[model samples]
Target: MQRFVHGFLLLPRCSLLALGGALDALDAANATLGHAQHSSLCLSLDGRPVRCSTGTKVQVDHGLADAPELQSLFILADLPLPDAARDGHARQLHPWLQERARYGMLLGGIGSGAAVLAQAGLLDGHRATLAWAQVPQLGDSHPAVLWSSRVYEIDRQRLSCGAGTASLDLLIAWLGRLHGERLAQALVGHFGLDRLRGADERQPSPVQARIGTGGAKLAEAVALMEANLGEPLPTEEIARLAGVSRRQLERLFKQHLDALPSRYYAELRLMRARRLLQQTGQSILQIGLACGFASGSHFSSAYRSRFGHTPREARSQRALAWRDEPDQPPSADSGRTESPP
Candidate 1:
C-alpha cells in the first residue's frame, strides 16, 4: 500500500470542528483501505500546543522548522480572518510556506487558513473559497484572488474549504482522487454521512431556515428580500412576487416570526449590517448604504434601537475585543483549554 504524510499546520484559535472532522475522515479512509495509507502530523510554528476556538488544546508533534518532508500540508485556521491578518501570524510563516510550495508539496487550507496562503501570494489569481462570513473581509483584503462562496475549491495543488463539515467533504474528495471512488464511498458510509456535497455547491443561506416552515410564499418573499439587500424592494412588489397581498405577507410574518413584515425585513437588513460591522473593515456609512439605510443618521438610529448601541460603538467594541485577546492561556477556572508549550 502507498503511504503519505499529511501535515496539519495548526494556527492558534483554529476551529476544533474543522480539525477533528478532517482528521476523522482521514482515519476512516485508513481503516477502509485496510492499511495506513495516510498519516497526519499536527504542527505549530514553534512546536507549541495551540488552543482551538472551542478551547480544546491540540498538542503538536513538531514545529514547521523541525518538521520532516511532507507530501501535503493542510492549514487548519478557522478563526476570524481579520484577527489573523492583524496579528501578523501568517506573515511570520509566509517565507517557510513559500519554500514548501516550491518543493512541490500540495497545499490546502481550511477556513481562514486560505487567508494565510493569500498573504503568502500563493493564492493570487487562484480561485478559492472560504467561510461566507469572512468573504467580505478577505475579498477586500485580497482583491487579486478570486473568492467564491462555494463550500470548497481545488485549483491544481491548492485545496481550500470554508471549514465545518465542508472539511470532511474536501477530504473525501481527495481520498477519491488518491485511492478510488469505491474507497471514498466506503469511507462516507463508515462516517454515516448522508452524501458528499460537491465542491461547487454554494453554502445554504441562513434565511432559508428562518422562513422554511412559514410557507412557500413567505420563504420566496424572504429570499427575494435577501437578494435585494442593497436596494430593498417595496412590500407590495415582494407580495406580488410571492403571489400574495401585502396584508397577507404581513400576516405571515407576524404568525411565523412573531414580527410584522416591515419589522422582520428591517431586522434582516440590520443583522446583515451587524455582520459587516463585525467581519469587514468597511466604513460605517458604506455598510449602512449597503444595507439600504437612507442615511448615516437614520442607520445609526435604527441600529441603536435594534442592538442598543450605535454602529460606531459596535465597531469599537470589536476592535477592543480583538486587541484585548491574547493568544496566551486563559485562567484555569475560565474553562478554556490550553496546553503548555
Candidate 2:
C-alpha cells in the first residue's frame, strides 16, 4: 500500500484546539483506511516538549533539523508571531522553514502559523487564510500574501486554515485528495459533523451569528458597526442603514444580545482594539485611533474598564510570558524513526 508522512511543526503557545482538531481528522482518516496510509509526526523547532496556549505540554518526536522526509509539513502557531522583530531564534526559523519549502515539501500553516509563514517570506504570492482575529495584522504585515477571510484555503502546495474546527476542514480536504472522496465522507460522518464546509466558505463574523437570520436589521446594524470601527457610526445612522428606527434597533439588540445598541457598538470597537493589541505590532496609540478612540488615555481607560487591565499591562504580561518560556535545544537525532510501511 502507498503511504505518506505528514509533519506538524508545533510552535510555542500553539492552540491546543487547532492541533487536536487537525490530529483527530488525520486519525480518523487513518482508521477509515484501516491502516497507516497517512502517518503523522509532531515536531518542534527543537525536539522538545512545547506548551500550548492553554498550558498543555506536547512532547514532540523530532526537531526540525532531524525531521524525516515528509510529503507535507504544517506549522502550528496560535499566538502572536512571538515578536519576531526582537527574537533572534524566531528570525532564524524563517529561513530554515524556507529551505524546507524549497525542498518541495507541501507547506501549510494553522491559525497564526500563517503569520509565521508570512514572516518567513514563504507565503508571498500565495493565497492563505488565518484566524479571523489575525487577518488585519497579517494583511498589513504581508501585503504580498493574498489573505482571505475564508475558513481555510488550499493554494497549490500551500495550505492554511483558521483556528479550531477549521483545521479539521483543511485536513479532511487534504485527506480527500490523498485517499478518495468516499473515505473523506466516511471520516466526516464518523466525526459527527453535519457537513464539510468548502474552502470558499467564509467564516461568519461573531456578530453575524449572534444576531441570527431572524434579526436581519440587527445583523445589518452590526455589520455597519464593524465597517465603521475606525470612525464609529452613530446609533441613528446605523438604524437608518439597517432600515429601522433607533428605538427599534435598540429593542433588537436588547432582546437578542441583552445589551443596548450603543453599548454593543462600544464593546465591538473595544474587542477590535484588543485583537489588534494582541495580534499586531501596532502601538497602543495607533490601535486606539484605529478603534475610534480619541486619545491613548481614553482608549486605555475604556480598555481597562472592559478588560480589567490597561493596554500596557496586557502587552507587558505577554512579553513576560514569552520571556519566561524555556529555550530547549534540538535533541540529538536518534536512530529510531517511524516511516510508512
Candidate 3:
C-alpha cells in the first residue's frame, strides 16, 4: 500500500477546533486500520509560528514555498476575509496556491478558507461554500463562484466545508471516495458518530428549527413568514395559507415558541435585521426596510427593545466572538498524533 500525505495551510488566527478535528479524524482512521496509511504536515506562509483563532501558537513544518510531497492541501482562512490582493501575507499566498492548483493537487478549503481560495482564482466557476456572505474582491470584479449555504461542498477536486465538526464529515466522505466504503464505515464506528451528514445538507438555522420539528401548521406559517419578511403577510393570510384559522395559528405559535404569532413574526424580522447589521455594510435604514420595518425610528425602538443596543453599536462590535476563545488540547489518539503546537 502507498503511504499518502496531506497538508494543512494554517493562516494567522485560524480555528484550532477545525484543524484539531481534521487531524483527529485522520489519526483515528489510521488507528482503526491498524497501519499508517497516511501522514500529514502543517504549512504556513512563512516558516514561523502562527497564531490560531484561540490564540494558541502552532509551529508549521514548512512554509508555502517549501511544501512537502502531499496528496492534498487544505487552507484555513479567516472570515470577514482579509483582502488577499492587498494584504501582504495574502499576496504571498495567492501565487503559491495557484501554482499548486495548476498541478492538480486536490485543493480544499475549510470554513471561510473557500473565500480565500476564490480570491486566488482557484475556486472560480466551481461550486464552493463559506459560512459568510463576504466575497473576495479581485480587480474590481468578484469571482464567478457558485456559493452554497450547505454545511459542506465537494465538487470534483475542490473540497470545502463550514468546518467546525463538519471538517470530519468532509474528510470521511472524501476518504470513502478515495479508499473504499468499508474503511469509511470502520472510521465512523471507531468515532461512534451517530450519523454522517451529507454534503448537500444545509446549515441548521435556530430560527427555522423552531418550526421544523413538528406540527405542519406551525411549519407552513413560519415558512411563509420567513419568506415574506420584507413585506410581511397579514396574520389572517398566513393562517389561511397554513391551512389553519387565525386563532389556531396564534395558538400554535404560543405552544411552540411561547410568543403570540404577531410577536414571533416581529421577532423573526428583528433577528434578521440584527444579522444584516452585523454582517453587511448596509445603512440602518436600508436594513430596516429590508427586514420590513417602515421607518428608522420604528426600527431603532424595536431593535433596542429586543437586543438592548442600537444598530450602530452592534455594527461596531461585529468582530467574530469565537476568535478570542482559547484553543483546546489535542484529543487522545490510538495512532500517531501531532501535539498542539
Candidate 4:
C-alpha cells in the first residue's frame, strides 16, 4: 500500500489561478489512482483565508502556527508582494520551513515562492527556478541562491517551477516520487497531459518560443528587451546585439511581429512599468525611471497612449482588486508529467 502526503503554505498574492489549476489536476490524479484518500492540506499564517493574485478567495485548512509536522510543504507566492503580505504571512511561515528542511522533508517553492524560501535561509546553496519574469529582481535580492529559468527543478530537497501551468509539472513529479511513475502517468492522463518534463526540461517562455513568426535571433532580441525592461536599449543597439542591421531588424519585426522594433520595445517596457506600478508601492516616477523612460512625462504619455489609461488608474484598479478579493487556498509540488518533444 502506497500513500502520498503533502501540504502547501499559501502566501499573500499567491497565484490562485495556478493553485486552483493544480488542485483540479490533483483531484483528477487521485480519482485515476484511487487515492482520493491521499493526505493534503492548505495552510496559511494563522490559518486565515488568502487572496489570490487576481482577487479570488480560497479557504485554507491549517496554519503553520498550528501544524508543525508534514512530509512535504510547498510555498506558493507571487512577486511584488506587499510588505504586509510577506512579513505578515510569509515571514511567519519561514521558521516552519527551516524546521522542515532541517528534517529533510521535501520543500517546494512555486513561482517566486522561492523568495520566501530564500528568506528562510532554506534555499541557500541550492539551485532553484523561479518565474522568469522575476529573474532580474530575484537575482539581485537572493544572490546566495542559484537561480534558473526552467519550468521546474528539484535540487535535492528544494523544488520549484517558473509560474502558471508549470505547477502541474511540479505536482506530477511529486506524485511520481510517492507513487511511482505508474501513478504519476495515471494522474497526467487524468489532466490530459501527454508526458512529464525531465528536471532539465524548460517550460516555454514567450521570449524563447516565438509562436507567431520570429526566429532564434529575433527571439533572443526579445528576451534581451524583456530582461532590460527597466533600461531599454536603442534600436540600433538591439539590432547590433541581434547581429542584424537596423534595417534588417525593422524588416524582421514588420514581416513577422507585424510591429516595428521600436514600437514593440516601447510596449514591452510600458508593460513592465505597468506591472511595477500595479504590483509594487513604487512611486510613478520610480516606475518610470525603472522602465527606461527618460522622465515621468514620457512614461505617462506612453502609458496613456498604449493602455488608454494613466499608470495611476491601473494602480488604483489593482489596489481595488486586492482589497476587494476574497481569501485563497494553498499550493502543491507537481512537475510536468508530459515530456516536451
Candidate 5:
C-alpha cells in the first residue's frame, strides 16, 4: 500500500501554497527516506493553474473531488476565509469535510485556511487556532469553535497552523511522526533547516495568552481540565486551582464565558469528546470517560445540546465522507495523529 500526502488548493485563482515552507518540509521527508515514502498531489478548486500569494503560478493535476485517497490533505488558502466563502467553494467543500471523520483521515488548515475549515463547519466544537488578525472574526462567527491565539493547534483530526514559517514546523512535525526523528532530521537537513524543531514547537514570536478576566480564568481552568481529564477533580478543587472560591468561579464564568462553571465545564468536556469521536475509533463509553463525562448518556446529552447534533451523528458524518480506500490511507490522517511533545 502506498501512503501519501495531499495538498488541496482551496483558493480559486488567487492564493498559492507556502511553496518554500511546505514543499521544503516535504522534500526533506523524501530525501531522508530516499525516493519518497509519501507522495504529494495538488488538487485545485477547478483543476487548473493557480497563482500563489506571491504571484507564482502552479499547476494542479486534479480537482479536489477527483483526487485519490491521501494520508493527509492540507487546505492552503491565502487571504481571509471570507474570500473563499464569497466564491461559493466553502459551501461545496464543507459537506465533503463533514464526512472526513468516518474514514479515519485528518484535515489540515494552513494559514488563513482555518477560516475555510470554520466555514465548512469542521472547526465547531474543536479547539482551533488561526492568524491573529482573523481571530476576532473567527470568534465572532463561530462561537462554538474555541479560538486559540497560538500559532497552531491540533484538536483531533483537524490541524490548523498559522501563516509563514510556522507552516514549515507544522509539516515537519507531521513528517517526523510517520518516519521518525531520524527521517525528519534528514528531511530538515535536505531542506537546509539549520534549526530543525519538533512539531510541538511554537513560533518565534509570542502570541497574547490573555483574553479577558473570564477568558483568562477559562484558559487556566481548561489547562487544569486537560491535565486532569483522565482523572477529573471536583468542581471545588478546580476552583481552588484557578485561585478563586467556588462561588467566585461561578460568578467569573457568568461574567466572561456567559455560562456557569458546570455548564462551561460540560461544554469543554463535550468539545474534547467530539475530538475523540472523530479522531479515534474509541468506543463511546470509553470516549465519554476519557473526556470526563460521568457516563455515555451524560456525554451524549451535552454533545447534542452544544452542537445540536448527537455524538454519533457527528462521528457518522465524518466516517461516511472521508473513508480510506483499500489502496491507501486517507490524506487527512497526517495532521490528526501526531502526539503533542
Candidate 6:
C-alpha cells in the first residue's frame, strides 16, 4: 500500500489550533493503526519556522518549491486573514499550487486558507466555505468559488472548513473516507469529541453577539430588513412592525450600530446586490432590480460608490481565472480506494 502522505502548507500567523488539531488527529490515527501508513509534513514559503497566531513558532519540513509529492495538502491560516499572506507571498504560491492541482493533488484549506486558494483561483466552481465572517468578503472578491456558510465543504477532491475545531472535523472526516469509519471513530474516542460533525452543519453565526446586545427592538428591525432585502420595507413600516416609532428606531440604530435606519437598510440591499453580481451569472440589470435598485445607472453608481467598482467590472474581474486547471484528476488517482498499508 502507498503511504498516505499529507502536507500542511502553513502561512504567517496561521491558526495554531487548526494546524495542531489536524496534526494531532493524524498522529492519533497513525497510533491507532499501529503502523506508519499515514505521514504528515509542514511546508512554509521559505522553509523556516513560522510565527503563528499566538506567536508560537512552527518549524517547517520543506519550502513550497521543495515540497514532496503528496496525496493531500491543506493550507491553514488565521481568521480575518492578515495582509502579509495575500500580498507578494501569494503570488509565489499561486503557480506552485496550480502545478500541484495539475498532477492530481487533493487540496484543502482551513480558516482563511480557503480565501488563499480562492485567490489562487484553485477553488473556482468548487463549493467551499471558510470562517463565516470571511464569506461576504470572499463573495465580493473570489466570487468564482462557490462560497457557502456551512462548517465544511468537500467538493470532489477539494476539502475546506471554517476556522478552529472545524479543521479537526474536516481531516477526521476525510480520514474516514480514505481509510474506514472504524479508524475515524477511534480518533473521535481518542480526542473525546461529542460526535463527528457533518458537512451540512453551519458555523456559529458571528453576528449573534451583536444581535444579543442590540436590544429586542433593534434586532427585530434588523430581522425585518434582512427578510425584506429584495423588496425592502420603508423604515416607518419596519419601526411599526417592531412595535416602535420611526424616531425610536432611528435612535436605536444610532445608539447600537452608529448608522441611521435608512442608511443601514440601503447598505444591506447593496451588499446583497454585490453578492448576486459576483456569485451568480445574473444580468446586471436583473440583479439591480432584484436588489431594489430601480435603474441600472442607480445600481451602477451605488455599487461603484460602495464597492469602488461597477457590477460589470466585478463580474468581469472574477472571470473564472481558476478554470485553467482540469476540474477533476485523472481516473488513475481519483475516487480509488487505497489498500490499507
Top lDDT prediction, candidate number: 2
Ranking the candidates on lDDT from highest down gives 2, 1, 6, 3, 4, 5
TM-score of 6: 0.66
Which of candidates 1 and 5 is the stronger one according to TM-score? Answer: 1
lDDT of 3 at 277: 76
Deviation in Å, model 5, residue 234 alpha carbon: 33
Lowest summed lDDT window (length 10), candidate 3: 332-341
What would the per-residue lDDT of candidate 6 be over residues 253-273, giving only the tens digit for each residue? 898889999999898888888
Worst 10 residues of 1 by lDDT: 332-341
lDDT of 4 at 94: 55
TM-score for each predicted model, relative to the true structure: 0.77, 0.76, 0.69, 0.68, 0.55, 0.66
lDDT of 5 by residue, 241-298 (tens): 9887889878766766677777766666666677667655678787788777787788
**Model 5 root-mean-square deviation:** 13.2
- Segments in model 6 whose C-alpha atoms lie over 4 Å from true places: 79-89, 209-341
- Alpha carbon lDDT of each predicted model: 0.81, 0.82, 0.76, 0.75, 0.66, 0.80
Candidate 5 residues lying further than 4 Å off, grouped into runs, are 12-17, 82-89, 197-341
Per-candidate total of colliding backbone pairs = 0, 0, 0, 24, 16, 0
Scored by TM-score, the top model is 1
Q: Which model, 1 or 3, shows the larger lDDT?
A: 1
Better of 4 and 5 by lDDT: 4
lDDT of 1 by residue, 1-341 (tens): 56889999998778889998889989998888888888999998667799888888889998776677788899988645424344343335776778878877788999788988988899998888878767655766688999987888888889999877889989999888888999888988888888888877876556556666448788788777866777889999999999999999999888777988778789888988998898778999989998899999999999999999999999999999978987754323332222321
Candidate 2 off by > 4 Å:
83-89, 204-217, 231-245, 274-280, 283-285, 292-341
lDDT per residue (tens digit) for residues 89-139 in model 3: 555676667776778878889877886787788887788876533321221
lDDT of 1: 0.81
